[model samples]
Target: MSTTTPETKTVLVIGATGKQGRAFIRSLLFPSANSTPSSPTTTTYPKSENWHILAVTRDASAPPARALLEEAKSHNAASKVTLVEASLNTPSTLRAVFESHPNIYSVFVVLAYPGLGAPVTSQREKEQGTMIADLAVEFGVKLFVYSSTIPIGPDANDGIDESRKQKREVEHYIEDLGKKNPNWKWIVIRPGFFYENLEGVFGAIGTTMYRDGLKRDTTIAMVASEDLGRVVAGLLQNPEPYINKFLCVTSGPVTMREVLNAHVRATGKPMPAVPGFVGWILLKINKGAKDLVKEAEINHANRISGKLPTFEEEVERAKSVCELQTYEQWKRALVSGEAGGDGELARRGSTDGKRMSTSSWNNLSLMKLLAGRS
Candidate 1:
């Protein structure tokens, strides 16, 4: 299954400073991040003899990036790899990253899409995605992994429109680039909606829509980010046979009620009501919200499943490294009498693009990855 050699392969990891990106790099850079790192050459920090990771960040000089460099250096792994500056906004910066590294073997795009509401974000992603794919082809990089979301389109009955439009646009853009650039292998990972989204929503409602009041029957697919990262990492070593194909991945299916139950376990609190009918009627007043509400209504109390992993199975993958618990784990964190047992609630502490230190979050991983495990 191993496509490359153990002699040494360089992984140019973009988004190396963010949540999923850091999770992946830290997994590669730190042996402690793994449940076991007894590899022969890496009795110290992981050696380049196996796999070296070139962690790239927008601000290579930033504190997080510096911390990473220092960590790699302290562990003696710095000599095995380098940290370069790159940005999607600036292709020149990204081009320099490729030019400086002749041995660049792969590209992992982990940043989020710009538009949560605007179509422009998706449009820009289509542009940047193709650009990255093209660069990989030009530089002779062996493989490129572009993280994506499940094609969670609007209701099957709603007909082809915006949801389907953006998903297809982004998917096709990278894929088309791969088609033209025969040298570069493309892996499009269509990850299901993240369970991470639930923690915050649950935190807000006091009671999850799953609390039997709101989205009782609404079904959604969820996966832990760590799981997605691991699968991508492992696949980089052994890719699926299908190229330019989209994967519908999820931990498992569960009702909003079930999620709420899990959240209450951690918070020891009831899920809140998602505004009553009046709230929905008010929300429906917005034209933009009309489709969203209709989509929600269609999924209400409906069952959905995927060929992807189950919730328990997905968590198991992220297990031993981090507490990849279902909502229920939230209960345990809360009940463990572990003070400051906040989960996604941390996302709420943002202001002007800044919040609490990310170090705290990374350090809190369930299966701790340490400095020299690999």
Candidate 2:
């Protein structure tokens, strides 16, 4: 096992290349850091601190991982970040990581979902999550922060979705670990739908809004990934009150119409809208498509249930830890093409283009299976 000084705090981040993982890494590297200036600064950074990140990825040579390393190097923070190659499915690799880094102060875990070349089953998610928690317990880690989705309903079995069920189970496993070891600190962050989902930036599932008709004036609870990052960073810095607490986080309950309007205003082009009939037909024919619709409906219900934290409340809490952007602020960045550049938009648009043709054929096959149309 590697040795560490008392001033050093090591954090292990799982799924470091994905959206949530990248957000956590950004927060750790530069708390409340942003790509653009003129963004309000709400949190202060220590000039010299002893926080280290063990960023885990299946491929350390991938573009995203390399880009992260490059960015850290540019900022002169290279020594603080380490890119380690490992997969959650392989217990031996994970064991090696834990063994090599005996001074892991905390772990930020975001369980994998199906997409982006990653075949993650609900069973695999539970097993991997539990394995990590078990290791943390065995190592006597100080804190564990888990990023999870908001439960669809109050009851454990309220939703019929297997993924939701798996999340709850993993949460229970972590909570049980904390209970068994009173010294271990655990925090669960249940974030709402990500803004990137609506922007078609996320792979595979980004087409859901278009498939669901993108109805105008319909509101959904959403949070910017960066904002969520800020919240996590804040919690890490001031973890006393958040110990064993579950935070339901959201940035805005913005309307779909507003999102479309923002695009039109930004790009000077009207957004495309799929017909409701077409969407319904697709949903009936494709199980995956139908699940997407069901997930949206469940989230809409949860938003109106008045059980979640308000945008203002969440913003205030996040501000206490780091600066965050509102929906309008994030939308403006997209519109102005100031976030990542045209390359980002082009990539998302390309995914949307492929989704249209592939999803149609998939839906048609299911339709034939059901209607005997073949």
Candidate 3:
């Protein structure tokens, strides 16, 4: 864990509705509001005057997002977090949010604006990257914790995955921010795929797959959302000397078989069998194959060695962290589609059973996962 002087500071976080932002927000406000505001000279607008937080969001009125804001306010965090319009297409919209507050100590850019038109490009990245850094510089905010992703290179034998492709532009610009400026605290956290995306499998709902009684295989390297939240919280709470650096955080990775067994232990069920075409057929009979095909490819990659976690350990930890029922305590929970509720559990949100939020799945602040100092 990194270290930062403890004090009440204002924070400006972009993409607050997404998983990463939500985690970041919850973590910041959850335990306490010990945040620092940015300096005056470094940011586009001075954010060192007072403690005023602004959250950038695409649609402030969306139910789930609105619910989050309502929760924040209910928690007496009305003075801590506020939702403001920040669209990916318009960089100024985002800039306006951070600039809106002259007292922001830290600015967590959760998403980048679509530069020009391409999915990933330095034009958009550099512009916003520079703007974010400039705001930090102008505001005197010592920390500029932008969320980033891992460039799927060497460690990622997966042939420069899609995320890497999108990251090309962001990586260069942010690296430039680190090199050229070198003063503001800039870091990235490049994490692996999240575990929350795994609950919607055919087996979870009870449709078995049988190809000559030989089940298909599903592999995965998944990260826990709370872990993601925790590290972000920990780093922000204590960014010691790691500021202005990039590092990775993961509990470790494992396979579907391992994961299912743990889930079974929690739910008191038989080990889930990985299904084949029959499962796909069952899916087609019920939901559809578009998702199944993608799952198959993901499973294939996991089986081949994707960055997943040790299923057994994750389940054990989840039992404690997620308050999962012991086998006897889980039957009804599983059937009712309500395994975890309250107690830091992932909330039920849109995007089908995605335990985490949207920003994570669609790639929010991959930088925070990739290069966070404190």
User: What's the CA error at residue 69 for candidate 3, in Å?
Assistant: 1.7
Whichever of 2 and 3 has more TM-score, that candidate is: 2
Of candidates 3 and 1, the better by TM-score? 1
Write down the lDDT of every candidate, Cα atoms only. 0.52, 0.65, 0.48
Q: In candidate 1, what are the lDDT values of residues 280-341, reduced to their tens digit?
A: 44343433334333444443323244322233343343232223334454335334433120
Give per-residue lDDT, candidate 1, residue 139: 90
Model 3 agreement with the true structure over 243-344: per-residue lDDT tens digits = 765544444444445555666665567654444554454444422223333444553455346353333333333222212122222323434544321212
Tens digit of per-residue lDDT, candidate 2, span 116-187: 212234487789889999999888788899887777665566555566677888888888888889988998
How far off is model 3, as Cα RMSD? 11.3
Clashes of 3: 71
Better of 1 and 3 by lDDT: 1
For each candidate in turn, the TM-score is 0.67, 0.78, 0.61
- Model 3, residue 16: distance off in Å is 0.3
Error of 1 at 358 (Å): 13
User: Residue 62 lDDT in model 3?
Assistant: 78
Q: Indicate the TM-score of model 1.
A: 0.67
Measured with C-alpha atoms, the lDDT of residue 19 in candidate 1 is: 54
